[model samples]
Target: MRPLPPEALPVIVAARRTAIGTAGHAFKEVTADRLAAPVIQVVARDVACLGVPIDDVVLGNCMGPGGNLARVSALGAGLGEAVPGATVDRQCGSGLAAILMAGQAVASEEMELVIAGGAESASTAPLRAHRESPDTPYERAPFTPAGHPDPDMGAAAEALAAARGVERERQDDYAGASNAKAVAAREAGRFAAEIVEVGGRTEDQRPRLMRPASLSRLPAAFVPGGSVTAGNSSPVSDGAAVVALTSERLRAGAGLPGLRLRGGAVVGCDPALPGWGPVPAVRRLLGRTGVSMEQIAAVEIVEAFAAQTLAVTDALGLDPLGADRERVCADGGALALGHPWGATGAVVVTRLFTRLVRSGAPPGTLGLATAAVGGGLGVAALFEVV
Candidate 1:
């Protein structure tokens, strides 16, 4: 119930974002772990942890070639094997899941210091082996598809849009907002401090990491049925983010990058109608913090689907067209840059921390991240920058 400190606000000492190139392009040759190593190092390089114990490294990843990617990426980051790790699969929710876990370890006083973040290289990320039989659980269950990811994220969005009564015009409008917001942020250089340079396979036979000129002008890949399009939906991209958290007493006694963990939680909905997942998650966070929506100035919820975002807004009685949600994701969001599955949560949190750190920033700024997975699985996290 207590407030987190500025340093205790899970001080995001440093942050980085990769340019979200189109699927299978610049980052196509890179693996997820390789893509994430730089982000982890940048955040950890400046911290002094000689005697301070690192509780663990918690990571997020939605797609991988095999198993235990969190651990793989952690050790590969050169953080060492002495530190334990966890790889969470919450579909699009993985990144936020990692941040929530890191916050929990510190808030519960379970450990004083921790490394938490998420990453995803959806572009090069490989697909999983499909179920061989109708009896297979992965095939039979629904994902709000009840359990099957038959149509993938875009298809799911289309289905959700129809189910939630979201009009095509509204979906188009939402996508447009995402584009404009991101353009504003980019022009303002808001993400200058957070987006890190992510190098990947070069195009045109150049031996360098040049920002793709068409990164923003790329066309849509999912609009056949209606408003959902590649431009509006997140692209298959590569990126990562990490945070260093410590306890109140320990931080006070030392000069390390200090960040106190606030409260965090997750919830689920019927996988078939995941458009409604954020309701309980938001309610739980607000209820736990006792902070009313009116007191919160901004939000950074992951827009997995236009329907999901609209549903959460409707449930909260938030008018997307109004000023209250205006401060949300100021720089842009998944719909614009891209969604690197496991990396989105950390990316949003990293940006949220930046927003809180700047002077004259809004007060009682509440940071919340949510994601929908196959079969009604949704995860959410609420943060307060004190």
Candidate 2:
């Protein structure tokens, strides 16, 4: 890839995330803003040496109180009344989408510095009811119109598994490996640097040693007599993650080591098969950026469901069970780390920052972060260590 002008280049200087907590468990009492404030504060403090004022705070949120979550979080972090905030909602892809928006602002020379990421508190998301039927509550809003098929995420994952010929054994094995990897990484303190302690919890709430044998014994969770199971799916969780992005000029002045935002793409697909979104999104991103999958030193794809994850890897010609798997989710994924919806996208990017930048990888080492959205959308971003 060719070099971009310093003023128009966007680089991520710092990233931080609160420890993930299982919904209805560790973070049941916390609100979304509270979950995100500490992370934003830490990320902002980390980049204070750059001597650039944060122009805006952009956050992604799927479910929460109706007002602007980004503003609420920014204020909660004590950023004062001067800095402004915006929110993005793309279902599961919200976090990455917000980051892409921030990068665009910097790349377009519209802003010099921005705080961008996502936060979610499934435990405290507000209930909903249409105005016409005030007494009746709905679990979620429609992803498509009346004529289009809009399946629940779990059902869609099950259908995807059946259509893609992903076997139950493979899903269970993949999930088991993810858990094992996460446990090992935690024991080795691989996640210590990226995680910010929250609410007296110093470690992620999920991730256990789940062997394939034990996983195989679990029954189907979505469809009767089907392969998808709770054991192989990401749990609804609460957490927040944020990254500080600034122009390359500012980064150079500060002598900071960071990840340069190369390019990104967002694409839509059939609502019924939302999990397949990552395939085309990634393809378009690589084609647009003139980068190939072989060049990416690390890849992070949100693991919403084992079946969905397998389908995506298979379609992309990635070997989830082979040596290539090491380049993907090296420390495990949402299956082991827990999926905090809007926050998972930023979480993946944070993982990439840790893998490529914090680990002292060579400059220009490329990495990719992609996620399948809940409402027929996919988001992908490419980065290079600088």
Candidate 3:
């Protein structure tokens, strides 16, 4: 694919997300469509404020009903039957991939305006039963094919930690800091700009006050002698996020803050080391855009596990420890927010949208949103505050 000039890329006009709910708890009764509908409505309402017609709605999903979730969410959100929608499933990378697809469509002039994001409701996801074994039930299907290693997500994190030499103390410290940052952000009302109310809850449900000393005492969750722990890993969650994409001309006409989609990339790696998936994806994105890490002001890398988060940051030459890690999630990440599968990727972009546009950052500041998928895939996108 030919690289388009930065000016030719799509611009984000609006971004919003529902407050993430704790799986099987705060959102136990909420379906995926129910969780996503309100955010889509708000995002569409924001686009209507700009007087631009929505051309499409693309959403990402994992464990939700198998049909077109985008269509269900759109109709539920009152987008009207005239609007068509589609859903993408790339595991956890689904949300970022959907946004990237929308950007490409707009940049190619195939679409004038698009709404792209991801949604999930772990609390309400139905049990699965394969047709071959109708009476038997399963939690999740295999991500890799036969003959390939397909470790559970938790097991992969533990293996990555052991392979990378990430210490348990380091993982605990990261988790504790994540909670602190998220708590601080919530207390400061920093999340208000992007988070919309859902189920009468306006704040993420996972983040809590956790001391490092106590976090260190938690037992390992994956392997008996391993470092990955439930406390240091992202909890199952429920939520949705949506962002409006439009051409540069429409953005100027709307007179709204714009964030340009400079570049994006998706790549596949070994299924055994899925956590490192983001490394190649980000590298490809930076290579295509000619944007270096120093040029990027903020980053939102999904915190599926402290071990994997540390490994990715170390691989990318970013600070993965102490206060410096704030540059990555600034407000917080999945570790503190909650991981609603597909929605986490879109939530990360919403975080960047808040940081670069709503927060009054200087013009031309760069931000990154990236995620590693369950099936050995990594997706990444680069944006600039306009």
* lDDT by candidate, in order shown: 0.63, 0.92, 0.89
Instruction: lDDT winner between 1 and 2, please give it.
Output: 2
Worst 10 residues of 2 by lDDT: 1-10
* Residue 306 lDDT (model 3): 92
How well does candidate 1 match the true structure, expressed as C-alpha RMSD? 5.6
- What TM-score, to 2 decimals, does candidate 2 have? 0.97
For model 1, the run of ten residues with the poorest summed lDDT? 201-210
Tens digit of lDDT per residue, candidate 3, span 1-386?
Answer: 24877667899989999999888888899998888889999898888866767888999999997899999999999988988999999889988899999998999999999999999998888898889998999879789989998999999998889888889988888888888889999999999989888879888888998887778888889889778888999998999998999998888887888789988899999899899899999999899888898888899999999999999998888885653566899987999999989888999999999888998888799999999988788999998998
lDDT of 1 by residue, 205-275 (tens): 11121122333344445546465655445555666777776665565565433223445557777655665
On lDDT, the stronger of 1 and 3 is: 3
What is the lDDT ranking, best to worst?
2, 3, 1
Clashing residue pairs found in predicted model 3: none
Better structure of 1 and 2 per TM-score: 2
Q: In model 3, how many backbone clashes occur?
A: 0
Instruction: Write the candidate numbers in order of decreasing TM-score.
Output: 3, 2, 1
Can you give the TM-score per candidate against the true fold? 0.81, 0.97, 0.98
Best-fitting candidate, scored by lDDT: 2
Off by over 4 Å in 3: none
